[model samples]
Target: MKSQNIRLCFNNTVKALFISALLLFNTNLFAEDLEVTGNITQLGNDWLVVQGYTFYVDQNTELRGPNGSIVQFSFYQLNDLVQVKGNNRGDGTYLATRVKLEDVPNNSNEIELTGYVSAKGTNSFDINGTTFLVDANTIFRGRRGNPFSFDMIQVGMLLEVKALLQTNGDFLATRVKAEDDNHQHGNEVEVTGLIESKSTNSIIIGQWEFFVNSQTVILDRNNLLIGFSQLNVGDRVEVKAFKQLDNTFLAVRIKLEDNPQSQIEIKARIENIIGNDITV
Candidate 1:
């Protein structure tokens, strides 16, 4: 748990949302669940062999499937759903304790996050059966946004979390800060000049400033598409990016977006002028 000093939002990060929906739809089609186990006998380049089974895992995956499967543990594979109790083998696979191919809890591993008091999400965010209000003062640590939205966060996304992990297992982020283009994740940076243009993949963050995904720092690329695609030129914004080794994101999801030249629509027509009310 870290201090709840920093916070970020969807409009401010470059997180790639986990496409759980895609996985769910595909997995649900499996007829009969299956499970198997064997000692992790062979470890090879980009692949693992347990008993006589073979599987692959991402280079960055913490442990193939969890349950403390660390370096060189025997492993198991599940057909439709998989659950394991074991150790990691450092080779992107896990040794097993209790291997089963049963339906994973629909909402067990899924966690609902809430920042501190100022950044509650009760107005928009909810979990299993709980809700909380959110504001700039709240925090959402760990990137857990939605993948499909392009504005949501996801796993492996870095974030400035602002709450302690309660003994009961609840994420209480007081503030959330998405990492930036340079993998830096704090404070505000000055991106000056007029936005040259705006498009889906490319956005003119500032005059002569053409920001593309790979060029800028970000947490991940999940929900960033939403934030990036909806950007408006001339809309001056201040943000911070978080970076690790090769990633970045906006610090405070977009603390301010000042677009003086854009039209403000009050209803059916685009108004040339608008008052303090964005929509009334």
Candidate 2:
């Protein structure tokens, strides 16, 4: 009789175990299911790479993962998700999505650009044979293509760019980076030279070219005061600028460098002073 009782108990235990296993399998399936349409790849330690940039999709953001799991990503790891907004980096990484914490602003509206004054004057900056105007109210917040324009820009120049498009489909920039007292603090800067170029924009000591956007600027008097006509080929200068979408600049004020000074002579004659003198 005791053996028969033991057999009956074993059968009941087996049935309970089978029921427990079924419930656990269902739980796992619910946890790992994906809802969004993308691949799951490791970005870093504390982050996940969803579209292109590094983002942590926790309970804060509306983004979700397969199986309703939250995804977060990191920034300090190699092969990390790049923090760029667009797609294609020329190195086989093409993120077909645009990811951002917030929407990009219309930086094309009212810009400020600062770069070395060109021989064409702040009024006319020619690059690759294309002419662009520089003046007051030009924008400089980089929302356009390419981080920095070609190396044609210099230092110790003033550029104040506007956001208004001209009739010719170009932006109208007012000159503001030069001797303008309003922008006195942004005129001067200390920069090192790139590899072998004599141009003024700072770069690393031995590198062929330095990224211009990462360079520094000094805002002080006597840093950007040189007549545009006095500038020669391969002159080094500092600039305070406002940016446009096309990476153009409008000078606010300008100053010539005193180093390796050039001789600038001015001739003036006093004509007959014709003025209504008020005698007290």
The top-ranked prediction according to lDDT is 1
lDDT of 2 by residue, 1-280 (tens): 4455322122332222111111112111211101111222455443454322233333333332233343343222343222222222212222223223212333322322333343355455532122456554443332233343323344433333323345566745442223232221211122221122424543222212222332223222344324444444444443333322243332332233444322222111122223421110
Q: What value does the lDDT take at residue 153 in candidate 1? A: 42
Model 2 worst lDDT window (10 residues) = 17-26
Residue 53 error, candidate 2, Å? 18
Reference-based TM-score, model 2: 0.23
Report RMSD for candidate 1. Answer: 19.3
lDDT for model 2, on a 0 to 1 scale?
0.30
Q: TM-score for all predictions?
A: 0.28, 0.23
Q: Report, for every candidate in turn, its global Cα lDDT versus the true structure.
A: 0.33, 0.30
User: In each prediction, how many residue pairs overlap at the backbone (N, C-alpha, C within less than 3 A)?
Assistant: 77, 77
Alpha carbon deviation, residue 121, candidate 1 (Å): 7.2
The number of residue pairs in model 2 that clash at the backbone is 77
Model 1 per-residue lDDT tens digits across residues 251-274: 223323444432221111112224
